[model samples]
Target chain A: MTIGEVRENPAPAASVVRQPTFVVEPSKGWLALNLQEVWEYRELLYFLAWRDIKVRYKQTILGAAWAIIQPFFTMVIFSLFFGRLAKIPSDGIPYPIFSYAALVPWTFFANGLTQSSNSLVASANLIKKVYFPRLVVPISSILSGAVDFVLAFIVLLVMMVYFDTLPTWNIVWLPLLLLLALVTSLGVGLWFTAMNVQFRDVRYAVPFLVQAWMFATPIAYPSSLLGEPWRTLYGINPMVGVIEGFRWALLGVNTAPGPVIIISSLVSVGLLVSGAFYFRRMEKTFADVV
Target chain B: MSDVAIRVQNLSKQYHIGGTQAGYKTLRESLVEGIQAPFRRARKLLRGQATGAAELDETIWALKDVSFEVNEGEVVGIIGRNGAGKSTLLKVLSRITEPTRGRAEVYGRVGSLLEVGTGFHQELTGRENIYLNGAILGMKKAEIERKFDEIVAFAEIEKFIDTPVKHYSSGMYVRLAFAVAAHLEPEILLVDEVLAVGDVAFQKKCLGKMGDVAKSGRTVLLVSHNMGAIDALCETTVFLEQGKVVDIGQTPVVIQQYLSSLYDIADYSLQNRVDRGGSGRAKINYIYLATSDGLPLQQVLSGQEVMIVIGYESQIPLNHPTFKLTVYNNVGQPLTQFDSSLTNALFIQLPLRGYVGCQLGKLPLSARRYRLHASLDNGVELLDHWTGAYSFTVGPGNYYGTGRNVVGLKDVCLVDQTWQLLENAPEVHWSV
Candidate 1:
């Protein structure tokens, strides 16, 4: 959305007082998202992410072990219900590795979305007193979830080795795919968190939404069942592209995800851009009613 | 002009009166309204109604047409009674909340101490909280690192720096919190009434730091109920009344004008004063001067027999309730106190809702206006701690029963004593 001006200025103005470092009023119209302020406070982003990671693990007997435990057990349940019982097609790869691969990124997206969606309300204390980019709250909440993603990824790699599936040169596409997952997570997070500020019912609705979203993605079954045009049409749900791309990158799957990636990428970028603008619109009113 | 650090133009903030429910409506109410909106409109049309009944939400202007400017390196004081929009103005300037009308242009980096320890984590160590709290207050990482040792020394918590802040005593927590705030260096600083809390020594240390900040030539916009601090540090003071800017000028004159207005607020019944504290076991209904024969008097005279009666209402009987009445001059300085417990004054079981009076042999002060702070403690808990419960002026009179009037300028109160002057020099060698 910020193809225009994107700064709430960090002017080093020694001479121009009238130019003013900032002008405070009830923001009118569609203003820039002030991403420049977000960049200036990057260290706060790190500290907040660090705080979340540290505090979540503290005083728990399992600690970061829960990070691996959560996705692994969920994968086991999927392999049982979808793979063994339902005879769900998995593109000829082992279903455990198949589900585990998707679970790594899927867990990251789901937890990140849930945490970031609730982040603003949980940080009401900081919001009411201080002035900072409210964007930092949801972003840092997402960043903290990446730690668990990495830990879970290590387990997925170990599972991959056991299953004898290897990666190809397509692995280079992994970073963009992970980024797409994050953008999608943050996009939906911004919308829902902003809405949660207005309507607390969003909090109760999130887990249900996440559960439905996971099933909508191709985690339990391959997208190949729906033939050709419909198969590609299914990529309207963005995570389909992410999960399929991950499979193509790691397992050297024959289907290259052609139109699915294109459609999904377009949809995701749209979600992010619009989500940012909507978030900026709601940002001014947060402290007043938070 | 470049020298103008802050220019506020008719800045205002309006809040809905029953705002918590009105502004933050539950999703069910919103959903129901959304679904029923067309029907409601149709029903209104059928009834031939022209008014918009749904738009009947109440609102209040916390700040209205508030405009002021602070020159570069000037310390400006904001003074007002409770709910006078003082804190709202500071919040708007600090950008914590946006103004609904107009705007303010702040020239430099803003640091606000609206409340100390703004984002301190209780689970974190004192050391971690300093860095985290500093960062939240807009200090950079290196800035906090450079001042790390200084902050620790300032808080005097070197030994407990690594311990979790949750374990700290309340006093230590406040000290550490103020320490981080004291170290924040911004181009413009907006300080709220942070000095009102903390112990005597802590308040002095905080005041000393505030004075240092004022002398450092940075622009400062300060809001405080402490007139003494406002007068000591600020060159010009802005007086606010009922959400509007009432006066702004040289500090002394504005403070005098603000204090004079305190007398106007005294006429309101304490039942609705709103500015009071303590547990709600009992409430001070009103307080006024009374003649010895128990008729109410508007004012008293020095060297005259006077009685002050306190009216109160309580849910339960006050058990031998100890009462304290403190007198403060118009400048908010405590002048004298009459405490019942200290004097061993006896009382039977006090009625739940009734009057109690303390008789004075002679009015102790002369020729000045004074306010009263009356408090009741029912032995178990404080029932009321009402400041400025009443105010009256004493006419010039001979406090010592002398032929001349007592001058109140040199002291707060006058005491009686006979002076023989020891004309013989007392050289009778009683010590030897």
Candidate 2:
């Protein structure tokens, strides 16, 4: 080919004049989120979530089995420590089954809390190197914990069957509770993840927070034991509602958990929106700081 | 009314140059600043503020007053030296960082391959990373599954696809990462210099894949130091210096312009003052390359007397912290190396901050340029190093050497070299 011929193209491809379109502006306000943009990058979200799952299961002799083992072992320890030794109340359900049910969602929440908080910092290489919706990192981290949730749920189901206590009609309420759990986890995860990007101390503070949080929640005991007003106020800890609801729905526990569920759901959703805005506000500095 | 696929106008991104420690301003200080912000902004908007005189503790604009446009399907290359703001521009364009001033508008789905294999888990197998990377690039799970075999084949890593990426050589990781990114099929693709990771063959494949994407009527922005690749693939090029667009024009013209101007920058003085310190026993004060007369020469001709000057300071002088210099060929293969302390020049109880200037006469280095890899070591302990002293060219000269045949020879000999000679055989006189 002649040099000129090499320079001349066979065809004019897509000849559209490039013009400047949108300028990225820093999000204003204390907590402002453009969720639409994140929503648009949903494909990236799915892949990151999938990648987390595959990596977690990749080379081990027991692949997805590790997901079940973590929560299963934690449940065993909790049952032994609080159930047998402390003689904590379980709302009349078998201690193992009761704690395991609550542990399923709590494990999901705790894992999501730790992973998502560190997500922006941990993916510093990727964040610095590529551009996508920064929220995808932490959200995927939270979603990745879903694998453990599913695996542990199976164990929960087996435990329920072994105890010969089938879930009541209230079991249909399970999806809402699961969504509630996700919101609560994501909300808290977003705040910590954003904070962790700016202050690395957040990473150190997260595990200790999770440990303290497990004690604060009634995973070992019943929220009902707290009595009136305090019991109603106890729902301010959103997980109280989730754990109580899990027991009520699965074991047919008589404590209606009434206004507690309503209050917790509102609180969880509020945390999610607030956390998302906080994350978005802080996200502008992530590439620079991280 | 030209069709502009990407448009940037008056764009600027400012960054505080110091550590995050600067982030901690007292609450009272913040309150005072918060009260003043609105009035300051209003006054600036009403009348343009002048005299940016107080430059200390000031924000450095990574990209300032940058404006450009790229039509659909236009493949553009961004070229610049280190810290010249190529990455910053890409970050702003890709929406990684919001520009502090001005605006940039991008139409269509933008996918950035800033660092390939980003999100690859070391504990995960190559197969998993591919899917993960593909997803990060915005491909659907179903889409990746369908192209799974093709990606694996293109990476030429089918045998170890199931092996964790940590076990794969960096080359394999890069190949697999590029394959996933190439197949992502975003409307607009922004690539950084991460392609430097792969082997030559894989890089060629990556270039081909990028070319195919551009040909299929997709917009691409490529940033690479490889002039050959830029010349071959990019239709147009943009040159950025200190975060601003210096030139934007046709490919070969802009690249040639950039290469020439690179030589024009005479910041060789930075190499004159050297600071080497990092858990080291001996410290190097000055490192330089000088001509026969001990005059520092920025450029060198072949067969010249090139002296290596090394000044150092020792603390509790030991047997090592051996001052060494190694010259590597263009492809990073060590050519001719010299270590002073190994040759019994080890100075014991050396005066603190002493000078050790070694003059090697009649430097036999050929026309090709080489990097001086100077380091100090105590046996296996690496005390300090000047990773780079400036590189100077060696011009062809009248040296009576037959091995000069390898001077301009490119490719294999330039990398793996050997010397051979013609000798007279007593029995075989086969020449006509």
Candidate whose lDDT is highest: 1
lDDT score, candidate 2: 0.74
Please, what are the lDDT tens digits per residue for candidate 1 over residues A110-183?
99999989998999989888888999999999999989999999998899889998998999999999999999
Each prediction's whole-model lDDT (CA)? 0.83, 0.74
Classified by CAPRI criteria, candidate 2 counts as: acceptable
Task: For each candidate, give its TM-score against the true structure.
Answer: 0.74, 0.69
- Model 1 over residues B1-432: C-alpha lDDT tens digits? 327788787888987655333453789988988888667755643332321322346678899987777778889999887899998898888887878898888889999989988888888899988988988888999999999999999888999999999999998899999999999999999998887557767787888999999999988888887665776789899999888988888886776566546544544443245467779779876666766544445457778788887767788878888889999887998878988887757765887766677889989887788878989887889889987777788877778876787766766677888888676685675685
- By DockQ, the best candidate is 1
Which portions of model 1 show Cα errors greater than 4 Å?
A1-18, B19-34, B37-56, B265-432
Q: Model 1 misses residue B299 by how many Å? A: 17
TM-score of chain A of 2: 0.89
TM-score for chain B considered on its own, for each of the candidates: 0.58, 0.56
DockQ of 1: 0.34
lDDT of 2 by residue, A1-290 (tens): 00122234333466644444455654444544667878987888877787778667765898888878887888899789989999888878888888888888888888888998898888898888777778888888989888788888988888888999889999999888888888898899888887776557788999999999999998888887887889988888899888888888988989989899888998999999978876776677777877
